[model samples]
Target: MARKVTNTRKWIFTCLAWGVALLIFFPILWTILTSFKTEGDAVATPPKFLFFDWTLANYREVQARSDYFSHFMNSVIIALGSTALGLLVAIPAAWAMAFQPGKQTKNVLMWMLSTKMMPAVGVLIPIYILFQRMGLLDSRTGVLIVLMLMNLPIIIWMLYTYFREIPGEILEASRMDGASLWNEIRYVLTPMAVPGIASTMLLNIILAWNEAFWTLNLTTSRAAPLTTFIASYSSPEGLFYAKLSAASTMAIAPILIMGWFSQKQLVRGLTFGAVK
Candidate 1:
């Protein structure tokens, strides 16, 4: 009877988990479905789920209206560029904090993490002014620097956690072999942490890719990423629901594909130190 009860409970929980997963996934499913409908069908009084006739008009119309390839390339550049810069700065900072501790290290970490809690709006005016004066407004270089700084703390925190899991004794042995700081890190430490670093880079790229507020406020047509590309569909006239959905789907497809492919690496890196 106990074994039967346990099995029944397990089945119940399994069903509940699947239900929640489906519920969360419903929006993306709806968006993809809506993208295939006519504009009228997309926003009909009585919504059509799957009964309506599907069409490819929206995808073609979206491309006709804007340069999808340009926006896609911009997103790729900004996401990758910012992530690369973040990793370059974070790896060394994390190595130092993990290997060499001071009394204020914990305080400094907390301080950096605390900055994430501050709303971007608080500093918007000043940042905007600085960007304007420096000619950074609406430039890819400007946005890249902003994203890199925005994500730096999180990158450092993740790297620090991964570095902590590494045995310090190995580093000591490297030192005994006359491995300089650069060589020790580049050869001994970095190679061992590739999985963690790759996972961190992938996640950061996703975050930067999806960032809408900064991109919208900072960029116009020239330096705009896909976020701005999708926003262009919204005009004084009204929303083009079908075309908007198509553009949204197109904008998100690359990052979604990347995330899907790197799922294993992300899981492994996140669980790097979980077990002994």
Candidate 2:
């Protein structure tokens, strides 16, 4: 009787989980479906779900109206570049904080996290002025720097957590074996913390890729990413529903595919220190 109760509860929970997942995914599904519909069908009063006439006209129009490939490459560069830069700085910082105790380490960590809570708009004017003076506006390098700084705190915190789970004795033993500091981190610490680092990188990449506010405000042509590509479909006249849907679908497809394939690694990294 107890076994039967447990099984019944398990099945109920599983069904609920799937229901929630589908609910969350419905928007994306709608976008994809709308991408294949005509403008009339996309915004019909009754709203056509699947009975609409399917066509690739919107996709073709989106492609012809904007430089999709250029936007795509910009997104790829900014996302990967920012993640790589963040990791470089974060790994060392996390290593030090994890292994070396300082009087104000916890306070400092809290300060860093607090910065994320402040609204981006609060600092926008100052940053914009600085960017204009430095001529970093609408440049890939500029965007990369902003993204790297924006995500740096999270990356460091995550790495610090993962590093804490590692045994200090192992690092001490490496030092005793005459391994240099660089060699110790590169050869010992990094390999052991691969799962954690991988997850951090993936998360940061997604954040950077989806960032719209700064990208939209700062970029006009040169550094415009897929977010910009999607925004182009909106005119002062009105929103082109079918074209906008097509643009959104194209912009998000790559990241969705990447997330799907790397879900296992992401889960493993997130759970790295949970058990032990």
Candidate 3:
């Protein structure tokens, strides 16, 4: 009787979980399905869940209307560039804060996080003017720099937490063995913290890839990415549902694929320091 009750409860929880997953995924699934429909079918009064006249017309039209490859390349470059730059700055900063002592370290970290809480639009004017003056507008380098800066604090904080879990004695042992500072970090600290670093980098890449507002405003044609490509479908006239769905599918496909493949490593790394 108890076993039967437990099984029933387990089944109920599983059903609830699937229900929520389907509810959240319905939009994306709908978009993909809509991409295979004609514009007329896409926005039908009784929205077609399935059994619509399927066609590749929307995808073909999306390709004809935009340079899909260019936008994809831009997104790849910006996302990878920003992640690399953030890691470069964040690793050393996290190392120092994690291993070294300072009374103001916690305060400084809190202050850095506070920046993320403030609205991005609040500083838009200043950043925009700065970019204009510096000739960074519509440039890949400019967007890369901005994305790196935006994600830096979070990257540093996550790394700091991971690094803190490592015993200081290992570093001390390295120093006693005549390991130089560079050698200590390169050989000692980094290898053990690989999982945390990997997870942080993956998460940052995803964040940079999906960032729309900053990319939309700071870029036009030259440095425009997939986000910009999707935005281009919108106009004052009205939404092009089928074409928009196609564009969105194309834009999200790469990252979704990447996340699917890397989920194991990401999960392992995220949980690296949690256990003894």
- In terms of lDDT, the poorest run of 10 residues in model 2 is 267-276
Writing each residue's lDDT as its tens digit, candidate 1 over 1-276 gives 999999999999999999999999999989999999998999898899998989999999877777777888889899999999999998888878989978989888889777876888988889999999999999999999999998888788777777787999999999999999999978998898887787789878988999987899999988999988778766825658888888888888788888897776555444433332
User: What is the lDDT of every predicted structure here?
Assistant: 0.85, 0.85, 0.85
State which candidate, 1 or 3, has the greater TM-score: 3
Question: Candidates' TM-scores?
Answer: 0.85, 0.83, 0.86
User: Model 2: how far is 180 from its true place, Å?
Assistant: 3.0
Q: Report how far residue 4 has shifted in candidate 1, in Å.
A: 4.5
lDDT of 3 by residue, 144-165 (tens): 9999998887788778888888
**Alpha-carbon runs more than 4 Å astray in model 1:** 1-7, 44-46, 236-239, 259-276
Model 2, residue pairs in steric clash: none
Query: Cα miss at 118, model 1 (Å)?
Result: 2.7
